[model samples]
Target: MAARPEIAAVIWDFGGVFTSSPFEAFNRFEASRGLPKDLIRRINAANHHDNAWALFERNEIDTARFDALFLEESTALGHPVRGGEVLPLLSGELRPRMVVALKTCKQHFKVGCITNNVVSMHSPGQDEVQRAAGAMGQVMPLFDAIIESSKAGVRKPDPRIYLMMCELLAVEPGRCVYLDDLGINCKPAAALGMRAIKVVDVDQTLAELADATGLTFGAESVA
Candidate 1:
């Protein structure tokens, strides 16, 4: 039997894992706009690796440019949508269970937060990025490191960002476990030897993390 790897760190994805997924809000936005479900996702996926979403997250495109380009893409897909209409929906409510789990993880291992995020340009004073930072601030002390795509110039599924997180945590890829709600984001981490958990819900993910790291992360303890 293969010996179990010594898990030294736990890396988490901010948008989906720690908070509710923006995709849930995306669906609501689509329904409110009377567009087909997953329209935003389709528009995003259509561009994939080089999409407006990717560029915006990398800080290569500013908010106005992203808004125009995103509108164009949505229009091309037969739905005229405004980026302003979508940006607000991207910030999901933080889950308390995740916060508890994070605190528990910090007791036993190093924790890091990696997120694909866009620069806050909604107004000269406030935007989603600021709001997100504020929301995460409560648990910020628990994390050993926090990486944002807009600051890092790289996003998930690219492999480099995962390595960047590992480097920041001062942990080897083989000695870490990563949890993300998106399978696409988890793929590269697993490829680099990090045990990856695809979070479907708080319970399943915590259970999987326990299995991976041999740490008891039961919801009851955190609750």
Candidate 2:
């Protein structure tokens, strides 16, 4: 029988995994606008590599330009949605269970955060950025390294960024376990030999992490 690979580190995605998924907020925004559900997702996924979302995250485009380009793209898609209207919904409440899981993980393994995020170029955007920073501040100290797309100029699903993270942690990809809400983002990590979990439910993800690392990360751990 082969011995299990020793898990040396755990890498996490910020938005969807740590907080309630922004996708949930996106759906709410679509419904409030009387537009089709998943409209924002479809629009953002249209040109996955260089779309408005990707460009904005990479800081290649400011909020105002993203608003213009996003509206244009949605209009082309038959639903004219304003990017400004959806920006506020980008930040979701932090998940307490995920916080507990993070705490437990840090006790056993090196932890890091890698997020695809945008810069605050305007008012409410600035407010939103501050809010997110505040939420992350509570747990930032737990992370050994933090990488943001806006600052790094590279977003997930890009192999280089994943490699950069492994390099930052000074760990082999095979020795890391990664979690992200987006399956697309998890692909590159898996391809790089990291055990990747696509998070849908917080408990399920925590369970998977515990199994992978042979560490306890249940409700009891939080207590």
Candidate 3:
């Protein structure tokens, strides 16, 4: 292992970072449907690397295929759900404070986003593709670089994705702070020498970012 360097860049995970978590929506969906909690998550976790969700995120499969495949996967677990039904839930409300933190970080350090996102899944009633695009459009430009799994052909928890961001930003993993909502995702970044922050909420994440970057967001500042 190499010696750590002064933080030079900040890498963010999009969904649960800039916006609310889709898991919250998943739980709500499960409750409304009288299904088990974390049911959607359980299906995704079963084959973490090459499951239907993984294939969809990598754009290896289309929405129609994912719909049927996800249903198959879920049914095997006792509860069935079409992948199309889950797409709309992926759209999350953006966090204004987190966006402010990203803008603040940009002034001092290289900022980038690595998101494990699916290609457009135009589910019924809600055009998830359009919703995510419209919201991300305003936020994407704020980053010096952005990598979407749908475009990258690989997603986080894969060390390659973290390395790709470091390459794009011209920084080492040791000199970066990486934030994500999932511990499983954070592990790889941490293993690669980045300071990984598992985001639980807006306040916790912003405070940790300030601590790492010597920056301030909203009323939170680091001394």
Candidate 4:
């Protein structure tokens, strides 16, 4: 592209848009550690508490605690393994699709990355987002802002996190366009006046993105 299109800012999701789901992949690996496939699901359904990931994002918990607790949980559940098993998934499989969007955004307007990620790297079977800054997979190198749950201490479907991202980008929500694979998270952003796109497939999502954001996609570029 000759120059980035004109938009105030653009936000992209990490997992599905990138290589694949490191989150999903990690959970799958949990089986090797002797963790039941449903272990994570049950844990999330029950309390949403006790998990260091939540506290880590709000900046309440540190990396050490997050990692140790994860391992502890696994051992308690009869599955014991080191934390690094999760690292390969995030870095290796999570390819970058929004890189084009990021590149396009930065050329024209401000760009920010808003992801709900763990605050630090400590344990196994977790998305090793600490290296996200260098993860060419998600084109992390191109982001003007990278807000993951671990760092933000919050995940989507929470309006506060969306607003926080807007504030950090210094753009009004109306001027921003956000993309994620999950519609649940997009609802709040749309409600807040930020243009939102649910990225199901790269080309198709790009088409919707171009239409909604008014960014001119090349004739051949899929939405």
Q: In candidate 3, which residue pairs clash?
A: none
Q: What is the C-alpha RMSD of each candidate to the true structure, in Å?
A: 3.0, 2.7, 3.8, 4.9
111-161 in candidate 3: lDDT tens per residue? 999999887732335665577667788899899999989999998789999
Please identify model 4 stretches exceeding 4 Å from their true place.
Answer: 1-7, 30-42, 67-89, 92-97, 122-133, 136-138, 148-155, 216-223
- CA displacement after TM-score superposition, residue 41 of candidate 1 (Å): 0.9
Q: Which candidate model has the greater TM-score, 1 or 2?
A: 2
- Give the deviation of candidate 1 from the true structure as CA RMSD: 3.0
- After TM-score superposition, the amount by which residue 25's alpha carbon in candidate 1 deviates from its true location, in angstroms, is 0.8
Report the lDDT tens digits of candidate 1 across residue range 1-223.
Answer: 2223487999998887877888998998888878899999998888677888888889999888889889989999889997767777777777888888788778778999898888773233346546666667776668999888889998888999999988899999999989999898999999999999998988788778778877675645566
How does candidate 4 fare on TM-score? 0.68
Candidate 2 regions with alpha-carbon error over 4 angstroms? 1-5, 121-130, 221-223
lDDT per residue as tens, model 4, 1-223: 3332445888877766654555476677766656677665443333344454455546676656656765665566666544434434454353434565556557677777777555343233334454543464337667877777765567766788888888888988888888887787789899989888887777787778767666656633323
Query: CA shift at 98, candidate 1, in angstroms?
Result: 1.0
Local distance difference test, per candidate? 0.83, 0.84, 0.87, 0.64
Model 3: lDDT of residue 148: 89
**lDDT of candidate model 4 versus the reference:** 0.64
lDDT of 3 at 55: 94
